[model samples]
Structure formats: C-alpha cells, structure tokens
Target: MTHTTLVTSIQESTGKTAITLALGLLAQDGDETVGYMKPKGTRLQSNVGKTLDEDPMLAREVLGTDAEMHQMEPVVYSPTFIEQAIRGREDPDELREIVAEQFEALAADTDHMFVEGGGSLTTGGIIELTDDEIAELIDARVVLVATYEQPGDVDDVLAAADRLGDRLDGVVFNLVGEGDHDELENDVVPFLEGRGVPVHGIVPRKQDLAGVTVGDLADELAAEVVTDVPTDEFVERFSVGAMGADEALRHFRRTRDAAVITGGDRSDIHTAALEAPGIKCLILTGGHRPPGAVVGKAADKGVPILLVRTDTLTTVDRAEEVVRSGRTRDAETVEAMRELLADHADVEGLLGH
Candidate 1:
C-alpha cells in the first residue's frame, strides 16, 4: 500500500502551498518516489485550450511529477460545475469515485503520494468533497496548516482535530510573527500536544516567501507595462501614494521592495515615489498617463511601471490577493522554505518514517 498524506489548511492564504511544496521536496531528497495531486482545484488557468488548476501545474514543474496535467488535477471548481452541483444536477458519489480513481492511479507507481487540499478543510463541502471526506476516501493522513495571528488561533486547530479524529496526523503553524516565536514554542506547542494535537512545525513570517513578483501583480491586475524594466523583481509590500508628495515619500520610505499604487495623473506622487527609496514598481491606475519626466526617471531607476484601467482601490485589492495567493516559483524562496522546514518541521514524522 502507498503511504498517502493530505495537506490542508485552516483557512486561505496561510502558506499551505508553500508547506506542501517543501514537504514534497524533502521527501524527494530522501530518495522517496513521491507523487502529487490536488483533488479539487479552486484557482483556474488556461493552458493548451484546457482549463487546469494552477497549483498542480506548479507541482509538475517543481517536483517533476510524471503524471499528466488532467490526472494531477482531476476536478476544477468552475462556475458552471459549481452551479450544477448546487442545483442537484451533479452526483456526489460519482465525483468522489472519480477522485478516488485518479488517486489510485497515481499511487500505483509511487511509494508516497502528497495530496493537496483546497483553501480550507470545508472548501468542497458543498459537493461532499471536503478535506476530511477525501482523507477518509483515500485512507490518507491529514496535516493541517494554520496561520498563527493571535493566541486564539489554536481553537481552529482544535476544531480541525475534532473533525479529523484519528486521521489528524499533526498541525503546522505558519506565518508566525517573530516576537511570538517563544510564546508559540513554549506555550502553544505544549498546550496543543496536551489536547492531542501534535505541533509539527512553526514557520515564521518571511517577507521573501510571502512576496509576489511584479509580473504576477501585472497578470492579476491585467495591467500594461509602461517601463522596459524587468518585472521579475519581488514586491514584499505595497503603499498607496494618495497623499502629498512629502507625505507619500515618507510613507514609501518605510517599506522596501514595494509596489506604489496611485492615480496615473498624480505626477507629484509619481515623482515622490521615484525619489523615495525601496520602490520596486509603480502601479499607475485610472488609465491616466504619467508625465514624461516621471516615466524617464522611473526607467532610469530601473523600476517597472504598470498601467491599469482600474481605480486605485480596485487595484490595491487585486494586488493584495496576488501577494496572498503567491506561489513558490523563485529558487531563493524555495530554498528558504526548505531550510525553514528542515529546522522547524518534523519531516520524518510528516512522511510517516
């Protein structure tokens, strides 16, 4: 029998994908024949006239899994499919069987299979395909990834343990603030262990791991690149340049490797952003073109400027989503994640060694 592990999270944007990728890489390093699958894909991308899940495609690229794209991601949560399921036109048993068949096919050739779940444990509950349901279906162990924002976040892990029961292998706490590390290690971990929840890892918040590239932001906002500079630079944060020139500069100075979003007509803000330190990219909104001097200066500074037709608020919202949903595409970020996992996470325990 193949050893199967299902990696899910308490909620969205909790570095679930990063954790999954790191664990897969660690397993491969151990000379284990590893396979990957995402039973239900929430994010859709078009490739070769077929809509596929984005995460599984990334897995194929990074992990070099031999499975075809369709097999890697068996079901996509498209609008039509969701509507049909909600209207009682889709059969839950049939969908579950399809997922199980795909799982068995992939597990046939591998010693270990890493199954990635949706954004949360309850993501596919509407169609009867939640994380716990799939875990039971495939007889896979469950590892819950939860972001530790406050002391009460442990409640979410306890609830997940209750739902998963004996299948709950452990929990990984991600994006933990630096100051709270001692508290989590000293207090939270022991408390959870007492409650029958194993603490597998406590990964601190890393800016590089959480950052999205300028190209990713452009794709998310559908913006036009006005500058010829490279868009591969990582944007660790973002600042809104709606204030006066001096105020904007002061605000921009506080952040490093950030994207500045403001009205394109705000040449004053644009000039201030270019003058300020750590501005990686300029996102000009409202379709208004910037002055030639501002564009020339940005180009000279090697900062890419993105032009979008959306308003400042909308652009900011989309940019935030990109950062939260960012993938582990960069080599440095992946290496950093591997190191963090090695130091903090129990790789052997997670892989059932």
Candidate 2:
C-alpha cells in the first residue's frame, strides 16, 4: 500500500507548526497513523552529538512515537554551514540526498506522515535546491497554510500554488487574526475558493493553543498571577462565550479539564464556573466583580476563582506563549501534554489499535 504524506508550508512566522499539530490531530480522528517530519528547519541547538527536531515538544507528545531528532529533521542548513556549502566546502545536493534517504526510510514505515517545511515553499534556494525539489524528492502532497490578514496575502499564496503546480493537493486559508470567524467565512474563504484552492480548514485565531494554566504561565514568564486562585491547580483549556449562564455551563462541560476565564461582569459565566464539575479554577479576566451567589458557590465547592483585568484575548495569548516555553515541566503538566498528544495526534491515529 502507498503511504500518503501531507505537507504544510506558509510565509514567515505564520504559526505553521501550530496549524500542522491541529490538523494532525484532526486527521488522527479517522484512525490514521500520522508521523511528523521536518525535512528542513531553522538551525536549533543540539546536545553535543544529538540533533533535535526544531518543532515543538508537544509535537512528539501528540504523535507518541520515538525517532532520532536527526532522522525526523534530517536537513537543517545553518548559516555557517550554508557559507561553507557556498564555498564548495560542502555538497548541498549530496546533503539533501542523505536527508531524503532518512525521510524516505521513515515514510516507508508509517501509513501517513505530515511533513512540515520551514518558512515559505521555496525558501532554501541555496545551490538551487529549492523546497519544491525536496517535495518532489519525497513524492509528498502539499498543503499551503496562509494567514488572511496582510493585503495581497491571497495573491502571494496563489502565486505559491502556481509554482507548486501538480505537487499541491489543496490550500488551507488560516485566518490568523483577532477578527471574527464570520469575516473569514464571508470574505476570505470565498477568495481562496475563487482561486481554485480547496479550503481544508479555517481555524479562528484561538486565544490559547494547548490548554495551559495561568499559574503555569505566570511561573514560566515570571509574571505575577493577578488573581485569587492558587497557582498550583490552575486549568488551561477554555471555550469562551458572551456571559450567559447556560452557554457558560455548556462550554465548561464540553472539554475535560479547563479554567473558565471571563469578564467579572459575566455573571452567567461566573455562575457556570461555580457549577462546573470539570472546572479546575475560574479566571475572571479584566478584574470584574463576581456575583455574590457565584462567589459563595465557588468557595463552597473549593474551586479557585481568580480575577484579572487584562483583555480576554491578550490574557490567553500570553498564557500560550508561557506554556510553550520550558517553564513548567512538572510531572502533571508533562503527563497531561503527553496524554493529549497520544489521544489526538496523527501518529496515534496511524499507530493506535
């Protein structure tokens, strides 16, 4: 049987890694084994002789598989290395062939693998070995991820699609902004469709990427937790709704362990926080007052209810940055991340019985 491969590429700093992980999880839902490989990457530090994958640690957690980082990210051209190769000290084609060999070996073992390329599609034109050539070498299907924010972004993405030609399977327009999801549906999605690119998925700019706690974030960023809840038992997952008690309760229960962070004036969310069985803590973002009844219930249930005045989206964004950093590496956090990966990532789908 032919093992399929999915490729994700985007402009610089467009959160390609984030998109890859989320999609990898979605693909896993169909019970497909998803291996992750980065054929090219930004040069990251290695442990003496150990080469590591430049993707996020959470990636391995999601896939639940073990391979040498060097094998996973086989072709990383550092600045110094690039200079050397340019000066005829190193053969770029030979290096690429070696990397491709490792990639093919891994691809042969998996049912479907998600390979993420660094930056834009044709970034590494060094010695004229472009990303397109690399994709051709591996015989993988390409998926373009573009953030629908900058003017002419669609044009840029379409141009990329044109260059990729037959290797391109489809495109996924990622609306990576603080704007409404409806705007993407109304404005952006149609634009990509007109260009004949299939819209695989549209992910609204989530305030939080992986569910991580405020205390854990504070500890990581070394920022103070401007809330009442103890930092230890804080929850990270969230589904925000305009302050309605019924909606809040439903959102709270939809995910396993999460903190319901909302405005203090959102009495409905506060009430739901008090009642939610799965809630680890209640973060009242933007320093609003909780209803007396809601406060009383939270106290009685021994659930920590916190209050902060920062804007809701900003708070979540900061929290995600902190969590991704190697700040809170306790047993619980590690285990939680690992569990999430095994349950949701592409490797698990392909590997799990």
**Local distance difference test scores for all models:** 0.86, 0.61
lDDT string, candidate 2, 10-86, tens digits: 66545566556555665566666667777766535565765454473556775675866667777665666578867
Q: For residue 133, what is the lDDT in candidate 1?
A: 98
Q: How far does residue 242 in candidate 1 sit from its true spot (Å)? A: 5.0
Show model 2 residue runs off by greater than 4 Å: 49-51, 56-58, 127-129, 178-180, 210-218, 221-353
Top candidate (lDDT): 1
Question: At residue 36, what lDDT does model 2 achieve?
Answer: 78
lDDT of 1 by residue, 1-353 (tens): 78899999988877777678778888999998889999998777666867887788778777888798768788787777889899998899999999999999999989889999987999888889999999999999999998886789888889999999999999988888798899899999999999989988888887767787899889888999988989888897789988899989888888888999999999999998988779899999999999889889999998999999999999898898788667564444566787898988888888878
> Where does model 1 exceed 4 Å of error?
213-234, 241-258, 267-282, 287-310, 329-335
Score candidate 2 by lDDT: 0.61
Quote the RMSD, in angstroms, for model 2: 10.1
